[model samples]
Target: MINADARWLRQARSRLRDADPVLARLIDDRPDFDPRAWMAQLPPMDLFGALLFQVAGQQLSVPATRRTLARIEELFDGRLPSAAELLNVEAGQLRAAGLSWRKVGTLRELAERIADGRIDPDGLSRLPDDEVIAELTAIPGIGPWTVQGALLIALRREDVVLPGDLALRKAVKAAYQLDHLPAEPEVLAIAEKWRPYRSLATSYLFSAAIEFSAAIEPAGAPTDAPLRERSTMAATRAGKGRPR
Candidate 1:
């Protein structure tokens, strides 16, 4: 299993302190930034389940997707099913377990590939970023956005960002008060300044999105917030990729 208590956080922040002049001033402005406490609150999870979660969550709203995931646990008698067990289940049962027919097909294809050794889910933990993307994208319905997200949540890899994610791009545009949502390459170019601590930066951007959305809501609106059209949890206990 990968170590969740990666020391990258401390090192990255230190580098940022010395490397970026403005960040150095910002750190001085708020001397008590606590990276450890922030990280400690993020739940730990295995890479494989995260990948499954990512695939399962694509294009689903957060609450609806969670209900479906809970359905999967219920399907396997209150636990996440093993890969082999997943293969043995009837496709209809999986659909009943709460996936759409398309998602059911996507999951089965992924499982079959892994089980047959055409793709190695376990091997993902050890692969580099580009290799992980290359390997994972070989599966049906898996794409760069999916892989970029898995890399962040599952591996807890630093500096990886899903530039194509609409939520994140929108978050950045709103947070930074940019004139327009940046394109993918522009997103990458901007995120480069956040290197090594980009994961932490991502956390802030997501927080900023929630903050911005709240700021725009009617003052007397209900606390539950308006239902999102197709918003998946950006951060997952494991995979849970950004919903397109």
Candidate 2:
């Protein structure tokens, strides 16, 4: 099994350069919006913590999610809970931590899978993007968007596009000034040109999308506002509680 610590990002970055022209320009543009630089500043994170982030962030506002995760930490030993520790927490207590029952179940399942080697976080860093997505999505409650987000954030896979993310679709629509949300087909059509560095372009689009979404908000709103609030509510209202 490949250890995550054995992964080398520089090699991957070189491999991703020509993933596509649109992506290539976004990545190769020297001194032009280096997204990886921001990633570099983030302290090295563990695979388990990354998985917890995925569960906690699912279908919730970022601030709200963080608050909930903090509550979960309080529920634990004042630190991030381990998979074994979480399994011992009751379902009722789990709900009290602000996670839906569905998420609780999903998280528990993920832990079980990891413990049993049905899924391997340490190994995913070495698999190709498509293989990683396939393996992860095979687990119940895991989907394309969740897997895609994990790939970018945890494994730092650079070429995948999440056509199903509403935030991404909304961002693409606003960036291109589309009349409505771009359908998956249209989104894929645009993403096709960004073969290798699609991940970087996707991040830029997500940031730009947040800016666009908040452009029409009330001017008096506090800076504490979170973009995920709208994205989550809209999805929940539309019955999209599947963790985008």
Candidate 3:
């Protein structure tokens, strides 16, 4: 759990509410919002496992990602595997667990780095966001989006945002009433106003996007409707590594 200062939390809320009326309304509508609450329900993951989950989830729906992860955990006695444990597992077994060839290679590479001390989860935690990104992205298949997810879910950084995320762009458009989805640069510029709390702000935006999606999903659509039917919801929910 993150040790948040009470004063910082209060200040972030005040500043965010003051900076944007839309977000202010969101804050008002959801009084019980705790951005970090989603983390409570996730299976505990170390930094490597968090990165693995992020990679596993990319471009996939929340439920699909969970299914894949469940299969993976089943391979390791119903627990998220450590780097060493992952290394011990055969590539074929991981492939059987629904991991793509690319994802499997990425995981193996990540395991190797962790095992060799080239990528230290503990050390990465202490570095600035840019350094963390640079170091992690050095590994294959670890892109900016993956690192951003890690920054939020694993390191619990305060100011980071995932401008590269399509869901976030859609959320900005819907929540801010933009005619078109904001581009990456536009998202970054808008996020600047929510400085020092982008992570928290993102959480609220994601929640708002999710509520908006649920309100709009077809009345009789299957509860297990594929994620494509609700792209925004999947993306927003997946960004936090959780189901809506």
Q: Please report the candidate that would top lDDT against the real structure.
A: 3
Candidate lDDT values, in order: 0.60, 0.60, 0.74
Candidate 1, residue 86: the lDDT equals 85
For residues 179-227, write the lDDT of model 1, one tens digit per residue.
8867767877878888867766665554444545632221211111112
Ranking by TM-score: 3, 1, 2
List model 2 lDDT by residue over 96-164, tens digit each.
Answer: 988888778888898788878887777877888888878877766666666665676667676877776
Give the TM-score (vs. native) of candidate 2.
0.70
TM-score of each: 0.76, 0.70, 0.86
Residue-wise lDDT of candidate 3 within 114-226, one digit each (tens)?
Answer: 89988888888999999998988887777877777778877889998877665566678888888876777898999988887898888788777665663223221111112
Off by over 4 Å in 3: 1-6, 214-244
Pairs of residues at least 3 apart in sequence or in different chains that clash in candidate 1: 50-239, 54-240
Give the Å error, residue 14, model 2.
12
List the lowest-lDDT window of 10 residues for candidate 1.
Answer: 220-229
